[model samples]
Target: MAKRAFDQASQNQPTDEARDAYLEASRAGQSQPPETEAPAAPEVEGQETSEALQKQPTEAEDDQQKLQLEPEKDQTEQQQKLQEETDKEHPEAEGETAAPEEPETEPVDFSILKNGTVNKGGNVVNEDGKAVGRVTEGILKHLIGKKVDEKGNIWSTDGKIVGKAEPVSESERDELLKEPAPFESFPDAVVDKDGFVVSNGEQVGKVIQGDLAILRGKSVDPDGDILDKAGNVVGKAVRWEPEPEPEPEPEVPVDKSILAGKRVNKAGNVVDGSGVIFGRVVEGDVKRMVGRMCDKNGNILSESGDILGKAELVPEGEREGLKEGPFAELEGCTVAKDGTVVTPAGDIVGRVIKGDAKILFGRAVDEDGDILDKNGNVLGKAERWEPEAVERKKNPMSGRKVNREGNVVDEDGNIIGKLTSGDLQKCSGKEIDDDGDVVDYKGNVVGHCSLIEDIPKVEEESPEDKEKREQAEQDKKLAIQMSVCIEQCLDKIRPICKMITEKIDKAERTPEDERDEEALVREVKPLIEEGGRILSEAKGIIKGLDPDGRIAANAKHKSAAREATPEEHHLADVLKDLTGDVTQCIDNAKRKLEDMPHAKKELNPLWGLLNEPLFQILAAVGLLLAGVLNLVGRLLAGLGLGGLVDGLLGTLGISRVLEGLGLGSFTKSLKGGKKKGGGLLGGVLGG
Candidate 1:
């Protein structure tokens, strides 16, 4: 009976060995929760007594039954063990292996699905949230049998499309993990904590923390604080400021007036602050305008102008005598209040004298302010008349003379002389001829004139005149020759003198450290000697001449000799004057040269040659002629032709030539001759 019951229980268990093992396991652990419901066994009607099956007596029967039970129990335990082992080995079949990987959950973003089906908006996303066409095996395999929408979309708690519910690369999976956890800590409301935010009902795609948004050109900061990358608050967006504008430069004022008291520069434009202008004032333009101020002809005069200064005019009629006396005075020369009274004739600058009166054709008035004669006779009044010159007259017969008023006369009624009558009274000459007859104004013999032939005839030449004339001519020729020599000398010597002078100047100008005194001296020594010799020679020549020289030759002698012809006298005078000038020049040169250092030191052998007795004798001959020339020069200068001396000085090599010879002192002395050369030797020696 027990064996039948056990067989029945086992049969009522599952055909699946695993289910049956579970039932047995359930039964074995009472501490465990009830794993299976209790089973109900159907009751069976028994009619029997098979003594063989029921009886328990014999040892063989007991042993046989025990063997049968052991085999059956062993079979059942083996089947149950195999079943449990299979369940563990194949947990998927048991509905327990990792729960099908949970479909590789993504953030629950329903926007990736369209209601119950996937739509265009439900496009799948890669693990990085970049939109993709569909879920790949690489992504799907990770979510093997997990629940997924029909479109294979997966969702996560954060409502974001983190990844698709499919097999994805391990790298993709890692990328998904790195994404920020959803902002779900807050809420799904469109408005954020700071202000309003518009989010799609679906997913809010990648939202970076710092990017700015704008609406209607105005920057919007939904996060309110709008923190920068460094987490510092930045203000809302604003319009940019325009670049700073550049400044403009000021303008310069222009001057419009041409003669606005300013001078125009070479560029022809007027500048401010310059002094006034004085226009061209050439001779003959306007004499008074010489020093006066004027603007350009057409321009307006300056406010300060009335013509700046007074002008002195030299009229055309006065030009001829301009070189003499008051006329010769400079245009602006001023006369002293005391006056220039000392003249060649006498000091007549302020003296007054009365003279016999006659009126030829002039308006005249008498001493009493009436027109009358001393005899109480009425003289005719005149608008114009000639005035008479006063004179003293004598009667040759009585030795008596009458005064200018005809008051004093010889008592002789013999008619010695009569005072002529006119608007003014005057006296006529009383003459007595050899016959004791006086000649009247008509050439008639009114009275006898005495010894008229006894007077000298100034037109005839005298013996003394003849001699002086010849000498003057000789003097003049000598002067000409001397002048030629001087000129030639100056021409030859000027350049060399300039060179020497420049060299000396250079040496003097050089710094002390750079100076070479010995070299400079040696170089100049010979030149100095040459100049000295020339000067000494010239001096020697001058000394041989007479004291006054040709310049003092007797003009009377020359004039007398020339009485035969006027032209001859003029020529002789000129020649004599020229000779005197040459003589003086030679002396000047000599004195200047001898005084030079080189000549004094006697360093030049050439100087000895110049000093030779023969040369001296020859020079002596020239001196004799030079003396004559000197006299001639004086005569010529007195005759208004003295410039010959200047010509000679310039021509003479003496002074200028000496310059090259290192005779600067000698040159200076020669130049000084103008003041000292009153006499031949005086000029030379003084120089």
Candidate 2:
């Protein structure tokens, strides 16, 4: 404020007249380095600038002019007005004419802000009224077409107003000079060249396999974020959805028997040892594939691009130029001249040295009768396996047999079942399965065994013979039903008979003094009643089966007409006599009991013999059965009914002889029954 600047600039010191020329130099478009001066006072910083001096009055003018503050003056204008007043008021009071000197400085921390100054206006103004505009945040970035100082402190408007100047920041200028910037000015996005897969701009996982990606080593939904097993979000999923489930691979049919054959020649043709081509590798290499069905290494393309099977893994050591790549794992295996795929172990897995071979289910197994997998687990047994048909001269029932068609055949030439591998079971003493097969002890189906019905030599019959056969079948069924019902009735009858026999024994064991007629009557009545009912039912059933009394309906009353038609006629005659025997026994006991009321000292002795009626009834039944069987033997001469009857009777475990009756010695009784006096009643009751 003391040393006032004039309305002219400092001259080169040629003369006082040079002042106007210096002022003219400051106005012209020229750049000059600022004069290095001591640090300015807190105020009046604008008065020290050369531009201010160039606009100020000279000292002579300053001595005469008076200065006053003007309202609405900015910092710069205020400094100018105050400096003029100070110099005119106190011309030589301060360092106004001090000698030029070098200024000292230190590297002090630089701050764009002044102490206690609020930076609300987004600028730092020095005392000299110069604004420091840097792009600290958002200030002065859009000052287009203007130049900024190299230090980014000052803006140049090229003579324009400071506030209205369109000055540009260095960064903005640098951006303009660069190639057209990417569409994003700031570009908040970033990328990491690695395959951190993204979906909808969110990271999901990283690629591991060629087609697979994972998050935290686990699968994630590609359409969303990767969730941990607990459902916490680990990351977002990448947008790689599995390729649209490629249309399901088409199923291609390939003949599997081709695998049993020889390796193909280099020309892809299967040749014999003489090099004659028997077959050509139409699709896959014969060295890799036995046929279209082989899955050994290499494409099995039919040139038609139909994939028959997947390329199988060849052995590690033999993969190099091995022609029989398919047999790498199977040592000692060879394609026989007969097209048998023989293993090194002297076993054949399939047949035929070339083309398709049919390895029989029969005779293709180890001695243990077990079919083992490669891992040695028991898959099954090829029990009693047989050889080819030409070799099958031995009895089949002696063992289980397998056929070429993979069926298990029993010794009787019947197909009992099938097996994927050879049959491995014995055929002795096994029960027939529902499938008409004799299963091994392990329950695996062996070959088919002959059924009971199949054991008969059933020949094609004439129409009349067919009718008889049908009748025989019907009779057999009806007989079975009748026999079962009779047994059930017998089961009921036997208990009653047993009870009566026990009562009789008790009566005989008791002393005559201790015997009671009332108690005996009560006990024997129920048994006699129930036993009578059972006998009646059994007789009714026998009659239903043989209504004509064992004689044919067409038989006349005389001559050969008296010939018995079936043994069932004998059965009915015997049942009638048995009924009479029971009735007479009951009548005799009742008569003896009536006499007990009068002769009180003697209880009826009839109760002691109550068991005789049961024995008589049973003997009569035996006689009936024996005569019927003998008559049947004569009636069905060549019809093969004897064997069937035997089988059905076997179910009851009954034998050729009746239990109480000696049927073999009944010859006299049978001959005598023709005469009325010597009937079944007399013979069975031993009269």
TM-score to native of every candidate shown:
0.19, 0.24
Once superposed on the true structure, which residue ranges of model 1 sit more than 4 Å away at CA? 1-460, 508-622, 626-687
lDDT, candidate 1, at 40: 16
In model 2, how large is the Cα lDDT of residue 277?
42
* lDDT, each prediction: 0.36, 0.40
What are the per-residue Cα lDDT tens digits for candidate 2 across 418-484? 4432243444445445444656668876556443344655587799788656755554455455456
**Candidate 1 similarity to native, TM-score:** 0.19
lDDT of 1 by residue, 100-153 (tens): 443332332434322221112222444344432322211222222222343444
Q: Candidate 2: misplaced stretches above 4 Å?
A: 1-325, 329-461, 546-687
